[model samples]
Target: MPAPHGFEHLVRGDEIVILHHGVRAATLRGAKAADFLARIDTEDPQLLMARLTGNYRRGNERAARRHPRNQS
Candidate 1:
């Protein structure tokens, strides 16, 4: 499958990193999307740290608050 748009690939040491809009999204030491997703699914510490420091949760919370279904 083709890589996601707005994402660029980079190699660092033995790992491959995916940069989305110039920010890192995923990384795989073996350079495979499946590995990347699996690592993310397992909540690899590095990925978790990145997500926590990044805007992922913040953006999701904002969206949830805006959705009508979330209104009480």
Candidate 2:
């Protein structure tokens, strides 16, 4: 099946690599490739990454432990 609009995909070993602007933006294994390919461009990669990996929290105390938002 073809990738949804705005996405280009390639198969490397056991992974399907999704590229944006020629960068290695994301990779999906065979099982999830179909699910990802069904998505539209309205979804942002950053948000999808956060949802799939659960590691993109933006406001955790550790996230700002050294770099305070009010730094002058």
For each candidate, the alpha-carbon lDDT, in order, equals: 0.56, 0.57
Flag regions of model 2 displaced more than 4 Å. Answer: 1-14, 18-27, 62-72
Write the residue-wise lDDT of candidate 1 on 1-72 in tens digits: 222245455667777676767888767655464455556657554444345335333346667888999898
Instruction: Give TM-scores for every candidate, taking all chains together and pairing residue i with residue i.
Output: 0.39, 0.39
Question: Which segments of candidate 1 are over 4 A away from where they belong?
Answer: 1-4, 31-69
| Most lDDT-accurate candidate | 2
What is the C-alpha lDDT profile of model 2 across 1-72, one tens digit per residue? 222233455678777676654666678887786676556255765455444543344555565666766466
Which candidate number would show the highest TM-score if scored against the true structure? 2
lDDT of 1: 0.56
